[model samples]
Target: MADGILRRQIQLAAANLSEAIDGADGFQNTHQSQHCESAKFSIEQVVFILEKIHIMWESVLPRSIYRRSMFHVLGPVFSRITKDMLLIDDMAAEETLQLQGLIHLALENLSSLFLSLVENDDDEKFLDHHTWVQLDESIPSLKKFRKLAELLDMSLKSITAAWESGELANCGFTSSEMRNFIKAIFADSPLRKECLGWIVATPA
Candidate 1:
């Protein structure tokens, strides 16, 4: 029963996180006038889910269990999502480094949290505070990435961690290959212009 609830909560968290991240303006200079409505809609969806979640858990689990474990487990992940979206949407060029740093840190933290949960031998046990994200790729179902889209829907931080930890890459590739891959993924993305400008500015 607890496991089921945990899974459900994980899914809801991932969905809200995905919507928030996806709906956020990609450009640093996007004005609120352009983004206000989407932002409001995304936040409202998350709040609605959260309110229902509070009610559902209140009914299903003991008060002590909800207070002790769910709060701890959900809070960090929730905080990470909020920070990630805000950072990703920041338009100020002066804060680029700060944004990147937040991106790196949040992803690592979320990854660690996920690894702890997945590797936990006991489904009912709560983890300690400082356990780091493990690089283990043998985690089944997760290995094939069959669950990646859904997992991303639930947790991009862990997804980023998994990517940075090399669960997604098959072999070493040259920088050219990496560049080509990036171009393919972001060809129509906002990053496309940046990539083109870099290429144009580079020496032959």
Candidate 2:
């Protein structure tokens, strides 16, 4: 019964976040320089919901359960953003730059929030744990989506270097995802072709 309630709460939060993300389509299409100063509304909504969860459940929930629940809430949220926003074709460079800045701010705020919620007892255990590590860095889809966000605004040279250095794979990107993102963000060119080939030949 308790688990069911928790699940419902998480689902509700996820739904709210998805709605916020859907509503942000207009903001995303425009060059909202002011909005990028903070996180996007959708991302801020996530942080707000998570903060509520931390306040309500942190004392009652087991540490592992609390951590897992947070990820459960975030997984769908990140997936929605990745699919609807990040994978767009024909995004202008200015838009990509703004999006990346928002992403970076979102990540920073999330990391800070996660760290603040860590209990004193958890300090030693989580001493080396970045939020991504503590919250489960093994979620490849989530990590890859973030990596793709960073890659979105990078130059072809930097991207190829990252691919060559295995950073993309290390960040949990699949070959297909890498290729698709490249195709979506960049135009056809010799360098783009070479990068795509490298992505295919190299194991992700």
Candidate 3:
């Protein structure tokens, strides 16, 4: 019941925002930024939900199938749903030209989560724990982020490429924020420097 209620609420909120966004100007048809700030709120909310679900996939999912089948049974299905929602957010952003604002933050969160898992990855215990059966950092995980990045790329192409290229100047993160996120999660590693560099260089 709670899940159903939450889904309904999200659906309603998305619908309301879609209507309001369609009516928004400049951010929609011109270089004039109007509703971007508000769109940031809605896009961030959706991004948070997707990020949580992605993380939960690690903590959930049965292990027996993962080891025996070498496949992500539930990960793809959930990922698709998350991807579609993010697509909607992206389409809205494109119409409004509001890229790398709130949606970017969501991708950052997703990337950070993936980077954290990768940093702490224990090859010895990989899937034996049965806790993260559908995560994307293991055997066939989808790197870190997906749909969010696709949208970001569609809107902001160079920055995403810069990030993938591991260019510190294009990491897509901020200096202080990158420092803090890296220091806390990545302590001492090549990836720590790589990610920080990309973030610092990533253009807002």
Candidate 4:
């Protein structure tokens, strides 16, 4: 029963996070009015969600629940961010770089906290527990999401090279995802068309 309750709490947290990202929650309206950019607004909302998760890790939840809860809560968030924010059309290069930095730092901090690494002014101190390692390794989405951030800023040649080498496929990216990413990030050109064809030809 305790496990069920904890799982439900996490599910609710995930739902809330999704709502916030979708601008269903109140934060989006106020902030979007000022920024007038939906993608940037969504990234900020994700940062806010991460901050709340950090507090829960610090005080409310037991260490034992951290791995399970984080995986449950953050997995879909990775997908949401890719589909809604990262895969958007006509995103400015400058804005993409800035948002990439923001999310990369936020994710790094979360990863450090999950590993029970003590963050200080100078550097982080590692803890002697393997549970966090298990959590990190178990969630394939986390790895893909970070890679997606890198791919967002990569050149077409580099991106296609990574795809050809099976790096993106090994990172858990679907052909559909590659198609969408290419369409969003690259303008219509012979090279872009060729990349899209490659994605279509590849098997899942």
Best by lDDT: 2
Q: State the RMSD for candidate 3.
A: 14.2
lDDT of 4 by residue, 1-204 (tens): 277887777777787778767762221222233543554556567667766776766476665466556666777877676555444545555555655664575576565545542223435455334543444366667667778778868988787778878888888887877777778667799999987887677655
What are the runs in model 2 whose C-alpha is more than 4 Å off? Answer: 26-39, 116-132, 136-142
The digit string of per-residue lDDT tens for model 1 on 34-69 reads: 454454444445445545555666567666565444
lDDT of 1: 0.41
lDDT per residue for candidate 3 within 1-204, as digits (tens), equals: 244654554455445434433332212322234555554554555455545544543454344422222222223423432333333312332432344344355455545443334333455433232333344435332322233344344413343354455542232233453245234323357655665666566544
For every model shown, what is its TM-score relative to the native structure?
A: 0.36, 0.77, 0.31, 0.72
Evaluated with TM-score, which candidate comes out highest?
Answer: 2
The backbone clash count of each candidate, in order, is 4, 0, 11, 0
Per-residue lDDT of 42 in model 1:
46
TM-score: model 4 vs. ground truth = 0.72
Order of the predicted models by lDDT, top scorer first: 2, 4, 1, 3
The candidate, 2 or 4, that scores higher on lDDT is 2
* Superposed model 3: Cα runs more than 4 Å off: 1-33, 63-97, 112-204
> Model 1: C-alpha RMSD to truth?
11.6
Report, for every candidate in turn, its global Cα lDDT versus the true structure.
0.41, 0.67, 0.40, 0.64
Superior by lDDT: candidate 2 or candidate 3: 2
